[model samples]
Target chain A: MTKEHIVSAFDRDLEGIQATVMKMGGLVEEALRGAIKALETGDTELAQKVRKSDRSVDELDLKVKHDAARILALRSPTASDLRLVLSVIEISAHLERCGDYAKNIAKRSIVLAENAQIEGTVPALRRMATFVLSMLSDALDAYIRKDASLAEAVIERDLEADDMYNTLFRSLLTHMMEDPRSIAAGMHLHFIAKNIERVGDHATGIAEQTIYVVTGALPEDDRPKKDGTSITFKPSDE
Target chain B: MTKEHIVSAFDRDLEGIQATVMKMGGLVEEALRGAIKALETGDTELAQKVRKSDRSVDELDLKVKHDAARILALRSPTASDLRLVLSVIEISAHLERCGDYAKNIAKRSIVLAENAQIEGTVPALRRMATFVLSMLSDALDAYIRKDASLAEAVIERDLEADDMYNTLFRSLLTHMMEDPRSIAAGMHLHFIAKNIERVGDHATGIAEQTIYVVTGALPEDDRPKKDGTSITFKPSDE
Candidate 1:
């Protein structure tokens, strides 16, 4: 093949893999939103739908990984091209995990539907999910636009998600302590909140991949993380 | 360079990456063991030490990834050789996350040390950790020896971990419900159990990579997953 033709083919291959990643990202976002909506409305049907859709997300992720590896073997892409392929693999993996978290949330929503709503937990969780959803969208946009600053912004926004989660954690604890009967429901809500928090982390991971692809190095390891639930032994009321 | 010399160098490069992965796996296992010991004994110092040691694991993971990328770019390995390199990258990533879960357990252990013990949670968590540690070691051994059957066995063993986690989940909830004062400690123990359960999942992921490296395709997605916590609203008490 002519040199120009070969280079063009390689570019097309990279674009194809990236486009699939975007499609996968869209499915994940849909799944996240659908899961939260189901949680809010106690819609078991919607939750089941979200759970079923995750298989498509997983399939797309595998396709992206396989395509990127093929390009790595065939094109022998170097420098930024190589980084792009590696970053795509990492990004797709992160997106797939996010999809799994969404599925977990859906599963919990299905169960939580039968139980009495834990006071205000669902609305607070919805807000947190909304924030994390924005971060996922911005992270995907940063990858597509090659905008490092936007990716960095997504990383910084994770602090906000953490803060929201902590607030929810304290409130859920208070609700459970007041009524032991809500213990199971509160625990499920806590996991749902935790799942949303992890989605934010995965979004930040996607942002990091973008920064890596652009600058050829990951940002400093000391990214801001305000998650304190692991160390929190006392509810704020105490 | 002679063709034979180049081939030999590629083999050396692959070996170097694999050795680093084993080293990373060792560090992860140590961290898991230390974290459980700290939890069982309420040894805050050991917990702190386990948390500190995770940075080394992270650094080794970065080195392995960089070495794999360098080999891919320079050697342009294809077919099985390329799969080996990709698998190393994935295996290292899984090991790194397992390290993170261990660190989380350590962090929680530090907090739990100050609280009254939550009945039998610590011993149960330790048993679960031990089981997960074995799975991790076997997964690493499988990777080194290219034993797909051993890796498959590790994959099957995750169901037992999930079953153990479910038992812990119910017992912890019962304790919290019986005595509202233990809610904080119960939550912390629940998270610790969850962390160990995730370690098993990561080990299974490593095994899947080994399988992919050996067989060129991932196993079916319908592996045994008995983690019913997300779907269990009654806590086995109702």
Candidate 2:
């Protein structure tokens, strides 16, 4: 092949890898939705399905990373290409972790199904999941369009995720205190809330990587401040 | 300058960046120890000290990333050299987050001190901190030596950290159930344990990066899995 042809071939390879990442991300988003649906409806079968799908998520993540490494070694891409490969790898990792967070929620849903009911907290958890799902969807959209503002918007939602989590944390504590029988269920619910909160974090991570890929510079000064909400479970009624 | 001289200068730049990473790692290690000590002793002043120190860690991380990017752009490092630069950036990010985890522990320590006492979980949290600190130290050494075995060892320790966190988790639940007054303290302690657990996770992440840096191929098959322990909380006596 001519030198120009080889360079074009390298671009094709980078494009192929990016397509794989989007596919992987789509699967992950599906799993997150399925996990949440499983939880809301208490469907063990759907929860089991979500758990099983994580293996493919893991496989896809490995393929993306390995393919990116191959490009680095074979193409020896220049600065911009190198950044693209690196961002793809980082974003894939984030997506895989998001998959794991979903699987974690599914596992908790199974546990919660067998325990005493704490139905009050379910709406809050669902809202948290819905909000995070939108953040993730938008994050992926931002990546494709190279939209820094959209990415920034995705990151800003993380603050809302945190606030929602803090509210859930206190409400769960109150429920547990009111009925000791619900403590086990409460703990599992708290963990599910935490898992969803972390999904928001990983999504923000994707947004950050997208920012770096688009802009040569990191967001230095105006990085959004994380909510310093206390996780301490003090009931207001106390 | 001769071509050979230019290559040698590039090597020196890479070496300097590696040293900077180690310095940042050391500072993070110190911050973790300080955070743990402050938490264990309920020393709010020491906790304040750890929180203040995180700024230096953040600054170091930013400097490392910027320097690495310059090397990528200006020096145009070879494939292997590029991998080294990228690994340094990823590892530094991990270390900076490790520092944040410590800072978070410090922040929570301040809140815990003002809450009612829950003395039983302290020693367990201390042991968990000590274990994760050793894991991080070893992982950094593994990176310096390019020893995959050492990295694998560090990765394996994360299992133990997870087990320890689970134990601490169960005990905390028991305490919360036994004494409602301890709920607030128990919640804070649980958060501390979680922060420490994430430190172990970040250490494993560094070790994984080290393996990739040494071997052209990413470790595909023998990847250390997070322990799939049950998240269901149950009282020991029950």
Q: Top model by TM-score, which number?
A: 1
Query: Which residue pairs does candidate 1 place in steric collision?
Result: none
Worst 10 residues of 2 chain A by lDDT: A229-238
TM values, all candidates: 0.95, 0.89
Per-residue lDDT of candidate 2, residues B1-238 (tens digit): 6555555778889989999999999999999999888877889899889988988999998888778767766766656776788789889989988988888888888777778768668789889999999999999999999999999899888988988988888888888888877776676788788889889989998998888888855556444344332344322211
Which lDDT values do the candidates have, in the order given? 0.89, 0.81
Estimate, for each residue in A1-238, the C-alpha lDDT of model 1 and write its tens digit.
6555555788989989999999999999999999999999989899989999989998998898789779988999888999999999999999999999999888888888888888888889988999999999999999999999999999999989988998899899999999999998999899889999999999999999999999989887787543578756633411
State in Å the error of residue B77, model 1: 0.8
All-Cα superposition RMSD per candidate: 3.5, 4.5
Best-fitting candidate, scored by DockQ: 1
Q: Which TM-score value belongs to model 2?
A: 0.89
What TM-scores does chain A show, candidate by candidate in order? 0.94, 0.91
User: Per-prediction DockQ scores?
Assistant: 0.61, 0.30
Runs in model 2 deviating more than 4 A are A1-7, A221-227, A231-238, B1-7, B75-80, B220-238
Score residue A185 of candidate 1 by CA lDDT: 90
